[model samples]
Target: MSCCTPGSSRGGNSSDAAAVPGPTWRQNTTATASGETVQVPVPLAAGEFDMGDNFGEGYPADGETPVHRVALSAFLVDPTAVTNGEFAAFVDATGYVTDAERYGSSAVFHLALDPSDTAICGWAAHARWWLEVRGACWHRPEGPRSDIEGRRDHPVVHVSHRDALAYCAWAGKRLLTEAEWEYAARGGHEARRYPWGDALAPAGVHQCNIWHGRFPVHNTLEDGYLTTAPAKSFHRNDYGLWSMVGNVWEWCADWFSPHYYRRSPQQDPRGAPFGMARVMRGGSYLCHDSYCHRYRVAARSSNTPNSSSGNLGFRCAADDSSLSFGDPAAPQ
Candidate 1:
C-alpha cells in the first residue's frame, strides 16, 4: 500500500509498450560498506535508462505511466538506508528535533501497534492498517512504549522528508534526486523489475524484506520479518546498495508531479519544479502484490514534506565532488 495518504503524487508512468535496454558504460567503481554508514560509490552509465514501468510488468498506477528515458550523473549514495544508530548519532551531535518529535505524533503501522492502544488511535481512512499515534517518532517508532533497543541496525522510520533533509544537511550530503534514486536502485541492471532482476524471488530466495502471507493482516514473517528489518539484512544489489526495494519507503529529493516524466529533462532531470508533496521511492515492508506492488525498482511514491510514518525513512547521497577519490574502498 502507498505510504502517504491521498493527494500525494502517484508513481511515474510510461507510454512505451516494451522495456528498453539501458546504455552500456564501463563501471568506474562499486560501493563499499563500513561500520554503520555504508556509502556506495556509483559510477552511473550517464546516458539513458528506461525510467518507468511498461503496462504488463508493473502495477497499475496512473503515475507510473509513459515509460521514458532519463539520464543521471555519477554520484555517491549510502549503500543502506540510514539506521537508528546513525540517526541517534546525528541527534546526539546536533540535538536536532525531528518533525515527528516536534509534532508529537506520527503514523504507525497497525501490526506494530500496542493491543490496548488500538482503540484510542486513529486509522487512515483509505488504509485502515495505518494508525496515527501521538508520541510516535523515529526513536519511539511503535509509540511511547517502543524504543530502538535492539533495532539500532534497522532502518530508522517515522522520519519526515524534512527530517531526512536535516540529517542530509548535517552530514553534508543531500537526498537523492528521483532519477538518481531510480538509477541507484536499478543497480546497474537494465529495465528489470527489482534491483536484482524481474523475479521477485529469483531461485526461490527472498532478496528483500517485504510483506509475506497478507498485508495489513497476518504477515507470516516468511521473509524473516514482521515489520522493518535491519538496514543490511538482505543482499546488496550490483551497486552494493542494500534494501533498495523493500524495507522502508525512501524519501527522494524532488517534488511530486504525475506528468513530470512527460516533460522531464533528458539530462539529470530534477523532477517537478514545485509541488506540495515530495517524492518517495521503494516499496516498504507493507507492500504486497495483492495491494501495493510498488517495491519494483522503477516504481515510485510520494508524501508531504512533513509526513512521517513507521514505514518511511531515507538514505543520504553526496556529489562525487564532495568525497575524496583517493581510496575507492574507503567509505564516504
Candidate 2:
C-alpha cells in the first residue's frame, strides 16, 4: 500500500526456493551484452549541493528534512532510464531471468489491465489499484497478454533491485548512490522543488510525466501518458539529464533509511549501512499532488530488493575514472 511502488513477497511461489538461485542474481561480475548504442552516459562534475527538502514541501515521515550539504565525486550517469530494447539486448546476451519472472507474477496497475483480466488477477489488500498478475514481468508488463511491441523506447518496468544491478554489471556501470542521485538531480540549482525549477508546469507546459487526474480512478493524460513514456520523452535538465523526477522511479545504490540524513556524512553519503529495502528516487507516473506528491527532487521511497512493479525502473551510473570521454559504453 505504498504511495508509490509497493513491496512484493519473495520466493515467488510457495514451491520456489527461499534463496535466489544461480550466480547471476546478486553478483555484479556477470558479463552480459554491451550497453553501447543503447544510450550514452552523461558526465557530471563533482560539486557540493544542498540535499533534501528545506522548504518543508516533502513528506516528513519519509525523511526529506534536515537539509544537508553533500559533496559528490565526478561520475557518469545515464541520460535516460534503461529502455525495453536495451534490456532485451541484455537478456538476449546473458539469458538472465529477472526476479519478477522467477516469482511468476508482478504488481501491475489496475488501470493497465484489461477489464476481463482483473476478474482473474489478485488485488493487493492494502492497495486495490495494484493487481498481482501472473506472468507479468518486464517483457509482459501488464500480464501474459501484454507485450512491449512498439514501445521499445519506453523505460523497462518490473525490474527489481537485483535486476537493475545485473543490468549495471552487464553494461559496465553501476547504480547512482543516493547522494550522487540527489546532487545530479538538482542540476546545480539548489532548493528547487523540481529539476526544472519551482514550477511543476512552467509556462503551462508539462515538464515531466506524472498522474494528472484522480488517483486510482481516472487519468486525464495531461502529460500525454497513462503509463510510462519514452525514456527520453521530456526536455533535459540543466545537467543534461532527462526524466530525473518522473516517468518512473529510478533505483539508487543506497539502502533505505528515513533518518539517514540526520547523520549523513558531508562528503558522498551513501545511506545506511544496511536495511531490508533499497532506496528508489524520482516519483513514478502514478504520482499525483492530491495523494502521492513525491515527484519533487528531494523526495524518496523504498521497496524490498525483490519487489517490482510496472511503475518501477532504473538508470545506471559509474565512476568518472571508469569511463573515457565520448565512450558510448559508459553508464547510460
Scored by TM-score, the top model is 2
lDDT for each residue of candidate 2 in 2-106, tens digit (9 for 90 to 100) = 658878777532211123223222212323345424565677888998899967988777888799888888987878888898888878777889888987899
Question: lDDT of all the models against the reference?
Answer: 0.75, 0.83
Say which candidate scores most in lDDT: 2
TM-score of each: 0.86, 0.90
Q: Which residues of candidate 2, in runs, are more than 4 Å off?
A: 11-36, 118-120, 326-332
RMSD of each: 8.2, 4.6
Once superposed on the true structure, which residue ranges of model 1 sit more than 4 Å away at CA?
1-47, 55-62, 330-332
Cα error, candidate 2, residue 243 (Å): 0.5
Each candidate's clash count: 12, 0
